[model samples]
Target: MTNDHAETPPSGLRIPAEPVPLSEVARFDHETDVLVVGFGCAGAAAAREAAAAGADVLVLERFSGPGGSTAQSGGEVYLGGGTRVQKACGFDDTPEDMYAYLHAALGPHVDEEKLRLYCEGGVEHFEWFRACGVPFQESLYGEPGWMAPTKDGLMWLGENAWPYDTLARPVPRGHRPPVEGFAGGLLMERLAAAATAAGARAHTDTRASALVVDASGRVAGVVARRFGEEVHYRARKGVVLTTGGFVDDEEMVSHHAPLLSGHGKVSDGGDDGSGIRMACALGAATRRMASVEAALIVMPEAACRGMLVNALGQRFINEDVYPGLFSHAALHQPAPWWVILDEEGFAAYSARNPTAMPPDHVAETLAELEEELGIPAGALETTVTTYNRHAALGEDALFHKNPKWLRELKAPFAAIDPRVLARLAENRREATGISGFTLGGLHTTVDGEVLHVTGRPIPGLYAAGRASAGIHGDGYVSGTSIGDGTFFGRRAGRAAAG
Candidate 1:
């Protein structure tokens, strides 16, 4: 169960703030130009930018170090929409193209102008990271990445209205820093170092149990359980909620995203839907509930354990095509897919380099699937034969699998890990991704304002990252999340400094 891929809150989780006298009702522990709540990429960027802008910045993280889900990411920044990174990667993209792509991808569930501004800012933000000492090596030469398309396939041909991020024409636009090891992890290390160097004070090993609402109903600060004791920290400027999405909160997932395995455990206890629940308590209007989902990874450890069956009791898609979409395929098959793999498949996945070989390359027989997936003897035997037979010929003469994505294969279930689990159809739906979220918390303007339940912006408040909505739309390309974190973090920092 233990390996590099297993989820562990990134190191450096215990951050300390000097204690105050017990007599004081509130400690007002410290103050900053920008008070960033949740020290993930978004929060860290906000703190770093604010501090770099000569404003005292305060950063609070529930875990030991930075990197909410970001710490666990593959480090592929999806910076599309005419970003300098995009142009440098040798692709022609524009804000208009970004807006069109998202609109086409999401159909009616998107805001165009907000998305355009986000794209326009995306390029600048990427440059800012490099400008600020976070080294990002460009990936201009690699295999074509998975891209989504309109049912009509118009996104790649050129100018099409309402194009989604998945429809994005594939390009080598991703960038990573030169960290000797863990190519994706280096980015997080650099950002954390930058935040600390910029004089941003971060408190780790702290849990924000509740949001403090003043007599004026403005969000004052947070009442936290730190070091196993109650502590209060007030934000003089604004409280930015970059706590991240609720992937591991089983109760919340069951209540909201039912189609998925609601019982999935978070990498850490940090993502407990604290921000979402806090806003809801104060009457923050939540828009899409069942709509938004996250990257569902089926690893050795997960809550749901069962046999995946297809409509005709067969396997579909190259389940091991890529780690990102593997969970989606698991959750959305016409029927549950039968998990099939062998010792060789398991060992191959254990290797650090899995992309070199397909999951199917691992040998698996019908009997093996019967033991692993628990399907009936005859039904599973036929399914395995059909899958192996059809998959080898490079044609889904039976399932109509997308030819571009299909290849003949052995057992893919073991390509990633020896274990398997159930997921939601939305988890695989190309339109849904971390970029597809509609973040709404303090509803701060581009300048960052803490908004009331009625949509009135609170003075002395601001926000950046997925903590605020309308920053990203349906079709999020790579690198934009970090772009927003850096760009808006700096902007919010400057605004707070003023």
Candidate 2:
């Protein structure tokens, strides 16, 4: 797969950042046609696909068990483009519509080739998951929330939200597998079983330490530590890295993603930048390293009834936007945002969020509350006046909040501190703390070939999942990570076997 015009690294080929080297006279302890490192959604999908394609595949996992970060997720897979669930839910969607929505959502970092390929193959990928025994019910989740609390298969995770609503007709495409309790863990469980059933072997407690390059400067295998022994696993076809992102690595986060420093972390353990660092040592270029996804959800559905205001008490974002999107905007604003709510709104919020701190200030009038919060003299009053006027008319002229949540604000106003709301809220489903994960890593082609710093594919090396960056830009919609991981993982597996 070498391009004649591709730039080759200078002599003294730097090995991966691990302590060991490819020239350490390593002996092959295990051998396979395709070797996969890190058995999350990406690794599992790669292993299963490679094995299905008649390749001998071996998977190495760091943890002593299954389920990386994917298991802890909400198990929402972003699939549309006329997916079975979307069509079953009576929604008409086309690849063009999906592509348009993503193009607008991802902004400047959107990869055209990747988006095209993903949209075109979206339905096939969804079917692939079904073929692997991942069960997706045919029901549609009626609410416009993040994830389905039941076995419902389809949900509008990103419909009627900013940018997307204007680009194409909104459609519901978030597909969740029918796994009771935590859907993510069930997803990993089924995928892991499918990988093994497809004749792929998995070695847990094995941590890949370095990449093995041959005399031709081509990736030949992996060096991993297993049972206190340095073992070299030779891969005749290729090695695919799916070791997730660097959210757990504080040093790397500070260096590459400092903006995410203060936000809460919702990561599965062992997401510590090792995968990205390893690829970097071999001269893999990184993209969007500063891009991060921070969910700043403060309350449950009750939050939709209120308005989000900055320290200046000026309404900023449409509170009805997907909580994840709202959270992303929340991170950039000046601190000390207050969710302005009236008595009925407060009652609805408090019914579920009883622990939310007592209002920073409560007054019989919005003007008095504005002064108590130290916002400019008439800023809060004017904002409320305009908001309530439009709300009473069932319209949100400024932010276009969904009419369902719009209501006129009355006396006895209370400004709730978001930090306190985040703390007191019950859980991620009810109230999500400001949390984020890294979305940037080794740059790769849509097919998952790891690219050199000079825009050429590194021979015999591939990456997927959080180990590779291409799907989303700085902004994120729910379910994209898991979908990207599995779809690209299959692509990497097929490409490696070729």
Candidate 3:
């Protein structure tokens, strides 16, 4: 392969990263039965599946090693259809229950086929990860937070709290690998090793710049830049693109998901929208482009035991929903948010989370605290009075907050601004900020076949992971990304190998 034609754009290109024609290629540098682009959780799983299916799989990664955004995650895989771990933890979860919660929580645009398949196959998927050397313990971390604080294997990562709990039986479906803290790195380590062991060859620091299409408009291979030179790699069977999302691309984020522009990105800088653009050039359809996972983690979930109020000092959300759902609700509320806590509540939060942000304004009375927070004279007082009245009866009449978290607000109040805490954490390079990632990409079928704008599957081209939108529609659950990516990657790999 030569670099001379690499800089030239295909004629009448729809996007800057359009696919190249097979006729334009003078020679082929490499060939494989399946070409897996970007060695993230999805790519690793895809490579392993395709190679195990007796296909010559080759994985290309832009980074120095495996592990994309998956390595930066908390390593929680949402699985709950009566798996052994769930049984060991004394939780009876059925596929119907899992589907009910996910269908209700994932969105107004949920893909029923994909959701049904995922729910029904949850147990087998769990076993598959175990077969890949990913460890899971039977212990459960019963907490109301984002990631598990302990090495326990299970936690609730979604709206498995009050309101949703009423709809479906709540279960701890978020299964973490048995690692002390932030085990995403360990998860990817095992997955990458599994892929390589399955005979999938990987070339790191190789960037796939464009897709190659045959005369009939079928994807044939990829044109990549490696070692300061252009290389053409032909995929005799198919190509799978798993290059994550577009969160790291500021221009793409601002245009597609403007709401996520200012928030911190939870990526490793490889989610630049290049893979999406390349696929779109071949008439691939996209969905939920405005969808982004905005995490508003007000640490020491004990704060939910108090009250989350807006600038008007009015309670808006239940305060006990999943942190991501709470954050979405918070984003729609008035600016300058605060979690108002009484002395007892503040003391409890401090005792539990020593690193929790200190109260921004403390006063001996609710009236004094209201004044300090610049709320209207009687707004804060009236809100707290009403909340306390309902709370005294162990009931949240207005918001339907669970009785377990409802409590009366006494005197000596403290207000903590979560926005300030997020800013401070961002400055300190911590993951505590209001970080997020784009949740939308190329539209694909449950088999990972990319769909055309006319609802037809694009032959010889497939996508999984963030490069192609799967389970997530509007909101996000913490473990859904890794779970969806790995599960669908296998399906795509198998389909491509055939």
Candidate 4:
């Protein structure tokens, strides 16, 4: 199946190599103490912070409006470790625990210094967000799934799943802002306003074409295409690139992260890998470009209680892990995956999962389902028989699914693709069924200064959010992106201002 969205664009919009040297640049059309590209949460937060630090900041946004993929997100900020909200809700959390969990979740992608700074400053960052006008209620959601349908402040996105559950004292860290729907839009609204109020001027419909490097090898400004004109915007102090990742650029995705080729991209249009390419032109080093965060969300309650099987009809993962984690596993396994449930399970899930379409296959017995699915004569039957026996005993010895969700499958049987389950659940933004974005980008230090191949900082350049990599590795806990953006974005802005 050809994906039209991945078609190539004109050469002008194509990713660039080394930017034009500043000496070759004719004149500056605009100037600021600090220049920021991409007005998403990271850019907005960086602009606001730089402005507060007494730098004359200007932001360039590719979109006509403010929100980027952030607006299309669930708006859960992965925050914990004794935040005011956690304390107010009577849950005890510590930075040590949060650090431990993140250390495990991030795997080889972990930045020790950055993780230490983020965890140690987690509480203070939460306070800073509160001051920025983002609101959180002191409520908790006990159910296992994606973001709470309501405006509850706390829910479990993936923290309770193994091995994170055993890694730290598992607590609800996904803090959803108080918005009726799609809280990321609200977060962007408030933060964008905060940036403007902080005296940061934003130019909409502005796309950065290349970095402007001076003769001494410092990034002094940017060459941008705005309103169909090429203009030079000079930054006296520094330039911060927060233009997000390359998930939407099919060519880049295939080149860097081929595993994500078949999945749907979950980004706004601005994430085209141009930022990373432009930075790389100046010798910026990047890491983990192949790491993609695929999401598995909004599984029906019955689907939650059901089991997933690959082509061989064998259960491969615990049913209760974060949907994204499940999706990652599923993608690695053979395709044509199915989530099998019984009539009882469907009945339990139907009301909660109102968006779910009818099952792809429904049959009076397991044999009939296997025949319809074209599986070998008794493979599914044998798998289901073993699963039921173990579920009846409340013990999943093979995969260790939580006993509370374990149940025997009795006829009539129903089977649906796990991919369909992700698409049907329409409670969140960006992606519903299994959708994802790239998690890798230009490498940077803890202070958000972009690094070179020699492990040295490129003077006067910094990056944050998806623009900089090394936060998440193979798996992602929800809210980490927003949390990372706001947290490290501040550091980048401040570093640039200095």
Candidate 5:
């Protein structure tokens, strides 16, 4: 099983971004009706769906096993429109309501058709997860963070708390697996098991080096490297790229997502832009390549009780919005961000996490604290006075923070800088720090067919998950990644099988 046209370059054998001509292949080591690259959540779902659709499916994984960034996540699937879990939790949701909220929050260029389809198919997708043996409890955990405090199945993982709550009927859509800790590993394990039970064969430690194309420029197969040997696997139907994002690729990050460069990445190290590069070599179009999901992990509940101020000591965003939104806003503000908290707010935050780092600056009075933080004279005082005036009236006149967490800041104020840059200066990784992944990739159709820059679907080529920029546009909802991956992965597999 050798490709005479394939040559090891000076950099050694690597996944070629360019495609290989099928006429040069003397033999194929394996053959399948649908070939899936990268055995993460998307790959597993694709393989399962293709095999169940009566197609022979083969999955290639670069790692020793499955579970890419999906396993590193909190395992919350964003599902709405009156799912069984939602109904059991005594919450009413409709596809229209979900669509409206997503349309408003997803972006300046939201995918209307994909959003509508995702909302309409939410219930069916929930059922599919159940069929795959992914468990969901009926309980609801009303917490601030993405993951549920308990093994509860539902929570708010989007901008469903403050200003966005007024956009549509807010409903908890983050569906978590029934596990006490982070359920991402459990979720992927169940999905992979289901895929295996459905008769999908997976070849682990097999890195797809190049895509093979016929004379007509249609994708026909893949050339992979396994144990230092090159193997060609032919796909009679199509090839689906399910490899994760480009967050781990420094060069790619610096070129496209410069904001995320030098920041901590929330990836499984397999997201090296290989899949995206391979597709781009074939002239595949991309979307939102600059969009990223950066998380400023200051205790959200505690932040809601206090306030986030920039270097000039001015509030920019409502404290009660989703953390992802909060982080997005924080990144664009002036440097040296700080979370200002009073005694009560600090106590509440400390109770949530006892091991948190001490406050960066503390003072008995507002002016003293302002001086200690080296804020512009009278800036902190003016901001606090205005905030207290509105907070006392149970109203936020500026940013419109939720009234429930609003309170006047009195004497004895403290400030904590949660920026990763601040922590890195001290050579520490602890405390709340910025960590994120790239949210942009190849552009594809609803059926997961990769599209060209000219807006035509590439024959015999498909993609899903982070490999293809799907639902996310400008902003990200916590569970949407896993949700988008599994949902569209099934569609890609079924489409390729046909």
Candidate 6:
């Protein structure tokens, strides 16, 4: 994905404040109205909006190209309200409906009153992304996936839209692949292009090490270090920190977000809460540091990508479910053993993708199983016979595989079988990614004012994205994190421009 490059904060938590003249500095990187750290979705949104609002902007990125979490993400933004696509899909979606669902999902701390801006701003952001040249695949008529150019088209919200139901936030809320098939990343890419064309300056490999607070306690520009030396790039107006979560820093994450160690964390090794640390130095109030979702753990036995088997050696979820979700769910298994189901599971996998599995492999799965997969002939026959005899009769009675969805051992068999499938215990584990919903950030007003723990606003200190917490409350809705990145990034940019 080609995006206008944005500079990144220095790697790790090393924001050293060293003194060097502008000339002695390796590069003549000057200041601007805003300095945006991190180039992910949130940082991109904040920098672009600030520059477009007439601010001289300098965006920093640690990576070569733009697209932070967005680049690593599935690219689904969740706004619970009436969307143009939803109108076209003939499904009822409204801000109020989304609001109700969000409120229920997040409980009282969601800060909906302050969060109203997200709802009001979502339509504009969606349209804005579209105007920047994003593409949307229309669903077939009545198929929700087969809808029309009409505002009343049906939307097939993928797994990313799991929290959304048929109530207020109706169908067609998601943007189709912006490019040929790149999801939300396309929108971010477009914005990066727009930002670059607008003359927004950025540097990659240059890191923002420290928040330069003057002796008067007024927040000054940051001291950027590139190569081996320290180069100071000063921001006159303000500094906005958009660095993402610490998903890869095993020690840091284990300390802050223990539950997430196993999940497929989008935050690369670079997204260590550096922004959070810098903002906290300014006395920012962080919140909710233990929020976690299980990574769809993958079962090990299933060798190839096409044929996936669960504990019962059967396909648990729709094989078509985004592999992000699949991988996340699979690795969370209680035990190491996995089960590969018979012809029925293979058919489901095939339906999800015909090319996903080989035809010869799909047919005559039993004999092919022992051949392709080393299963003892005697045990294989015995296991299949037993499953066929009891599985359909509501008597897996052996494992008591939820009687609700048991099936007899049909024709094509699984390549591998689980020796033992243990149910996952819900108790807390030795490790977790329970870091709360992007808190420990500079608490800000809806206007995007960075505040101290004392509730006083810091001059020239602004924040957007996860770096600015509490706007999302203690719990976040499914699609809201990216949505917040877009919504509030713009909010901070607009405010900083003023």
Q: Who wins the lDDT comparison?
A: 5
Higher-scoring candidate on TM-score, 2 or 3: 3
lDDT, candidate 4, 351-386, per-residue tens: 666765777789998889888877778888988999
The weakest ten consecutive residues by lDDT in model 6 span: 140-149
TM-score of every model? Answer: 0.67, 0.90, 0.93, 0.93, 0.94, 0.69
| Tens-digit per-residue lDDT, 211-300, candidate 1 | 666666666666666656666777665666666655455555566555544324323345555666665556554433443332433431
Preferred candidate (TM-score higher): 1 or 6 = 6
Q: Least lDDT summed over 10 consecutive residues: which range in candidate 1?
A: 149-158
lDDT of 3 by residue, 305-401 (tens): 6888888989887887777777766667776678888889988878877776678888988878878989988899999999989999999999888
lDDT of 1: 0.50
Encode model 5's per-residue lDDT on 127-230: one tens digit a residue.
99999999999989887775666899998865466666888898988899988759999999999999999999998878888788899989999988877889
lDDT of all predictions, in order shown? 0.50, 0.79, 0.84, 0.81, 0.85, 0.55
What does the lDDT read for residue 203 in candidate 5? 87
| Greater-lDDT candidate between 1 and 2 | 2
Please identify which of the two predictions, 5 or 6, would achieve the higher TM-score against the true structure. Answer: 5
Give lDDT tens digits, candidate 6, residues 1-498.
Answer: 233222433444444334223333344357677888877777777777888888899887766777776764545566436566655555566666656555544444676665676666656777766665555444422221111223322234332223333333434444444232225566568767766766578877666766777665666677765664565667778787787664545555677666465433444446567677777776776555444323233232122222344433343443332333334345444322234556665565456443333333343656556545444444455556665677557655443333433556566555432221111222334223212223334467776677878888877677777666634543443346677776787777778778
lDDT of 4 at 424: 45
TM-score of 5: 0.94
Model 3, global lDDT:
0.84
Report the poorest 10 consecutive residues by lDDT, candidate 3: 1-10
Ranking by lDDT: 5, 3, 4, 2, 6, 1
Tally clashing residue pairs in candidate 3: 0
Error of 5 at 474 (Å): 0.5
Clashes of each: 36, 1, 0, 5, 0, 64
What lDDT score is found at residue 402 in candidate 4? 76
